[model samples]
Target: MEEIRKIIHIDMDAFFASVEQLDRPELRNKPIAVGGDGDRGVVAAASYEARKFGVRSAMSSKIAKKRCPQLIFVRGRHDRYKEVSKQIMNIFHEFTDLVEPLSIDEAFLDVTHNKKNLPSATLIAKEIKKRIKEVTGLTASAGISVNKFLAKIASDVNKPDGLFAIPPKDVEAFIEDLQIDKFYGVGKVTADKMHKLGIFKGKDLKKKSLLELSRLFGKHGAYYYNISRGIDERSVNPNRIRKSVGTEHTYQSDLIDTKEIKKDIQKTTQSLVRRLEKSDFKGRTITLKLKYSNFEQETRSRTLLQIIQGEEMIQKLAEDLLDQEELKTSIRLIGLTISNRINESEPMQLTIDF
Candidate 1:
C-alpha cells in the first residue's frame, strides 16, 4: 500500500492588512483597507473588521467606501509584505524543504518526512504557526490532511490563528459534508452550474459517474469526480515554474470610442511590459481579453513565430486583436496576457486568500 502523504496548508490571516496593523499600532481593531482610495482605486486587502461590512479585496474603492463608511484606506507596502513573506517562508524551510508556496501569504508543506522527524504533522503545523506569530506578529491558519486538496480546504475551516486536521479515516466523511463551493476549483459560477445539476455538496457530486461529470464540465469534471471521493493524487512540488506574465485593468467608466480604447490598450501594454521586465518572462502567444459593460467577455489570441518581449510589438498585437473583434458594447475591462512561454517544458506553480 502507498503511504499516506502528510500535507499541511498554511494561510496567513488577512496577510496584508495584518502586516499593516503589525507595523502601525494606530490601525489596530479599526476597519482598515490596504489599497488606493481614489475613484478607480481597488482594495488589495481588507482587515477582518473591514470584512464585517462586506469589504473585500478586488472590490472597487468606491463600493468599499459605501459598504464601510468609516473604512480607512492605507497605501499598499508591497516591499514590506514581500520582506515578511520571505521571513515566513524561511520558517517553513526550517521544518521541511518540501514547501510549495501558493502565494506570498500561503503555502503547502509535505512533512511526511520532515527534517525535524516529528511523527505528527499536526505538531509541526502548530510549531509553524507559533513561530510565524513570534517572528512576524501575525497569525496563520493551518490544515493538515492526506493531500493538497483536503489540506487547503481544512485551512479555511476555522481561520485566523486556527488549525484543523483530517486523518485518513475521516477524509471521506468530511468531504461528503463539504459544500460544493468549498471545493478547490469550484468558483461562484461553477458552483451555480453544479447546483443546477443537483450537486450541492460532495455527496451529491459523488453520485455522478466520471463520464457524466466529464460530459457536463468538460476536462474539469474528472478533477471534481476524484476530489469528491477524497482522492487527489497530486503531490507537493517545491520547484514550481510560472508559465505566463500579464497585466489587466478595469476602467472607472466604460470606454466606447476606438481612439480611447486604443490609448488605454497602449497604457495596458506598457504595464504588461513592466511586469514582463520584472519577471523576465517571454512568451509567443498574446491574448487580448475584454469584458463589456453588460459583463459579456471575449478573448482573442495570436501565436507569433518569435517571442514577444518589446512593448511596441505587444501593443500592436493587442491593438490588432481588439480591431479584429466587433464591438457590440462598450468595454469595461481590458486585459493583455502573454502565455505559451518560450521555454514550454516546465509549468509555473502558483492562488487565493483562503
Candidate 2:
C-alpha cells in the first residue's frame, strides 16, 4: 500500500469568515463572527480579526463579545457555503474520483492514479491550490503525504494559503518529534491524560510498551502506539458516504433539569438546521444525541415523511425524540443531526463567498 498511496488534504483558511468577507467587501479586513448573535449563541466561525482577541469557533457568543466588544456578528448563509463546497469538490474530482470531504471546508483526495500522471506530489499540491484560488477566490492549504495521518498534520503545519509535503523517508523522524497533543486522535481530554502519564511528545509516547499503553487507554492506546511509530493503515476511502452530520461539545458543567435540556436541544437544532440549509441537504431522518455525566452515550431518532428545514421543525423533532428517552443522569453533551438519502436531481450550486 505504501508503494502506490498518495493522499492529499486540502483545508480552506477561515472558510466561513473568509466567504463572508469575499461576498461583502465592506466586511473585508474586519472582525467578523458567523453564527448566532444572541446570549446563548456560539460562534460558527471567526475572522482573523476576531481571532486575535481570542474569539474562536464554538465559543459562546457572550464570551466572544466580552473578548471583542466591537465584533460584528453576521448570520451564516447556508446556500452560499454549499455553493463553495460544490466548486471545491468538483476540483477534487478533476484529479481523482477518490475524494472524501471531511467537512464543508476540508477534504482528502487520492491522486496516485490521476490521469495527468503527475510525477511529484508537491507539484500536484501546488496546482490544486492554484486552481482552488483561481476558481473560489479563497486561499487554501494543502498537505501531501503517503497516508492520511501525515498529510493532515502537514497541511496544518503551514496554514492560511500554504502547502507542505512529508516525504516517506522523513515520516519517521517527523512523527517522533511531534507533540502528543498534535496526534490525530488525541483530543484535549486524551492529551491531558497522556500528560498525567508523563507522555508529552511523540517520542515519549513511543517509549510506552504496547501492552501497557493498551491497559491504560483501552483501544485508543494501541492506536496511539502505532501512530507514534508513524504507522497508519487506513486508506483514503473515496466512497465514504456521510452517514450523519452533527456537532457536539462538552460543557463546563452538567445540566439536570428538563427545561435546560430543552433549551440546549433547541440551540443545537438551530445550528444543525443552518448547516442543512447551507448544504442544501435534507434528510428523512432526524437524530438526537446525548452524553450523560458518566460518559454514557445514547441516541434517539425519527424518520420524517419528507425533507424539512427551519429551526422550529428541527427543534420540535429533537424535543420529541428526547421526550421519549429516560434521562437518568446529568447531561454533558447535546447534539442534533439529519440524515438518510438526498435528492440527486437538485444540482448543488457553487458560490465562492469571500
Candidate 3:
C-alpha cells in the first residue's frame, strides 16, 4: 500500500497589507491597500477590511476606490516583503527541508519525513503558525492533509490566523461534499463550464468518467477527475525555480491613440522591471500582450542574445514590439512578460493551484 504523504500549506493573511499595517501601527484595523494609487495603478494586495468592500488584488485603483471610498493606498515595499519571507521560510526549514514556496507569502511543506520526527502534521502546523507570529509578529493560516491539493484547500477553511487539517480516514467524505469551485484547479471559467455540464460539486464531478471529462476540459479533465476523488500525487520541491515575472493592466477606457498606447506600454514595462528586480530574475525574452476592446488578444515576443535586466532596454523592447503591428482597434489592456531565463535549466514544475 502507498503511504499517504503528509503535506501542509501555509499562507499569510493579506501578507503585503498585513506587513504595511504591522510596520505602520496607525494603519492597523483600517482598510488599506498595497499598490499604486494612480489611474493605471492596480491593487497588489488588500487588507481584510478592504476585502469586506469587495476590493481584491489586481483590481484597478479606480474601481477599488469606487468600491471603498475610504480605502487607503500605500506603495509596496518588495524588499521588506522579501526580508519577511526569508524569515518565514527559515522557520519552515527548522521543521522540515521539504518546504516548497508557492509565493512570497505561501508555501507547501511535506512533513511525512520531517527532521523533527514529528508524528502529527496538525501539531507541526500549529507550532509553525505560533512560531511565525512570535518571529514576524504576523499571523498565518495552515492547512494539513494527505497531499498538496487537500492541504492547500484546508488552509483556507479557517483563514486569518487559523489551522485546519483533513485526516486520511475522513478524506473521501470530505472531498465528496466539496464544491467544484473549491477544488484546486477549478477557476471561475472552469466552474461555469462544469456547471453547464451539471458538474457543480465533487459528487457531480465524480460521476463523470475520465474519457467524458477529457472530452470536455481537455487534459485538465483528468486532473479534475482524480481530485474529485481525493487524489493528488504532487510532491513538495524546495528548489523549484520561478519561470517568469510579469505584470499587466486593463484600462477602464479603450486607448486609440498611438502615443497613449506607448505611454501605457512604458508604464507596464516599468512595473515588470520592478518585479524582475525584486525577484532578482534575469531573462532574455520579452513578450508584449495586447487585448483589443473586442477582447481579441495578441502577443509579440523577442529573444535577446544576452540576459536583459535594464528598465530602459526592456521598455524599448516592449515599445518596439508594440510598433511591430498596426492596431486594428482600440486596446483595453497591455502587458509585458520576461521569460527564457538565463542559466536556469530545470524542467517546469507542476502547477500549485492558487
Candidate 4:
C-alpha cells in the first residue's frame, strides 16, 4: 500500500589511505598507513596493503609497527582530505539533495525522487560510483536498499569498490543470515552481552520480544529489534548541523597537582579557541572532561546567555569544573568542547545580559 523508499549508502574505499596512494604513485600498491610516526601517535587510516598485515585505524603507531614492521607511515593532511570530501559531496548532490553525510568519507542519499528520474536505484548507484572515480580518482562502494539500516549493511558486503542491493522481497532472509556483531550500533560491549545470552545472529535477535530486549539493554534494545526486522523509519536528514567541536588528549604520566592540571587546561583551551576562530563559530556552551588514573570520568558544562569565545572564557569554565571535581587521584586525560550552534529555524538572539 505504501511506496518503498530508495536509499543509497556510499562509502569511499580506504578513504584517507587511498588518497595518499593516489597523490603519490610510488605509494601505490605499497603498505601505507596515514598517521603520525611519533611514539604517541595513532593510526588514522591503513591502506589495504597494510590491513593485510593486521594494521588498522585507531591502533597506536607502536602496536601497528609491531603488527607490520614495514608499514610506511605518513602524516595526515586534514586540509587535503577536506578538499577531497568536498569534491565527493558535490558529486552526491548531482544525484539527490537528500544526501546525509555520515563522515568525511561516507554518506546516505535518498534518491526516491532522483533528478534523472531513473526507474532503478541500482543504475543510479553505478552512475554515482563512476562519477566519484572520475572526479576524485578514488573508488567508492555503494549499497542500495529500502532504508538506511539495510543500505549501510549492503555497502560493506563487498568493499573496496563494490555495489550491492537488497530487494524488498529478500530483506527478511538477508537479515536472518547477518552476524550479531555486524549489526549497526552493536559494539564490542553489546556483542559480548548478546553472546552471553546465546544470541549469535539476526535470527536469534528476532526471536526475542521487544519487551525482553528492553529488559536486557534498556532503550537500545527496541532499536535492535526493529533493525532485525529490516524496519528503520529514520529519514535521511540533510540539514544535520555540526553539533560540537572538541579536542582531548591522554597524558603519558598522570597529573596530580593543581598547577599541572591548570597548565594542561590552558593548552587545551588555546587549541580549542584557535579552532573556533578558524571555523568562525561562536557558541554559548563550554564543557570540560576529566578522567582519573583509575579510569573514572566526569564532565561539567556551563551554558551562557550570550555566545562566548577566547581562551580566557574557556579557561575560566575549565577551572570551575576542576574546582567542583574531587582531585583525590591523578588525572589521565582532559578535554574541552564548545557548542550551541545558531540555526535559521530559530532566530539568533544575542543578549548582553549574562
lDDT of each: 0.88, 0.84, 0.88, 0.87
Expressed as tens digits, the lDDT of each residue in 133-217 for candidate 1 is 9999999999999999999999999977899999999998999999999999787768888998888889999999999999998
Instruction: For candidate 2, write residues 9-49 as lDDT tens digits.
Output: 99999899999999999999999999889876878889988
Who wins the TM-score comparison?
2
Where does candidate 3 stray beyond 4 Å?
245-282, 288-299, 304-337, 342-354
Clashes by residue pair, model 1: 241-348, 242-348
Tell how far residue 223 is off in model 2, in angstroms: 2.6
Ranking by lDDT: 1, 3, 4, 2
Clashing pairs in 4: none
Which 10 successive residues of model 1 have the least lDDT summed?
344-353
- Candidate achieving higher lDDT, 1 or 2: 1
lDDT of 3 by residue, 12-102 (tens): 9999899999999999999999888888677888999999999987687899999999999998887899899999999999999999988
Which scores higher on TM-score, 2 or 4? 2
User: Which ranges in model 2 have alpha carbons more than 4 Å from their true place?
Assistant: 1-4, 249-281, 290-297, 308-312, 330-337, 344-354
Superposed Cα deviation of residue 179, candidate 4 (Å): 0.6
* Per-residue accuracy of model 4 over 37-130 as CA lDDT, tens digit each: 7775667789999999999876778889999999999977767988999999999999889999887888999998999899899999999999
Question: Which regions of candidate 4 deviate over 4 angstroms?
Answer: 245-298, 302-324, 327-338, 341-354
Question: Which run of 10 residues does model 3 get worst, by summed lDDT?
Answer: 344-353
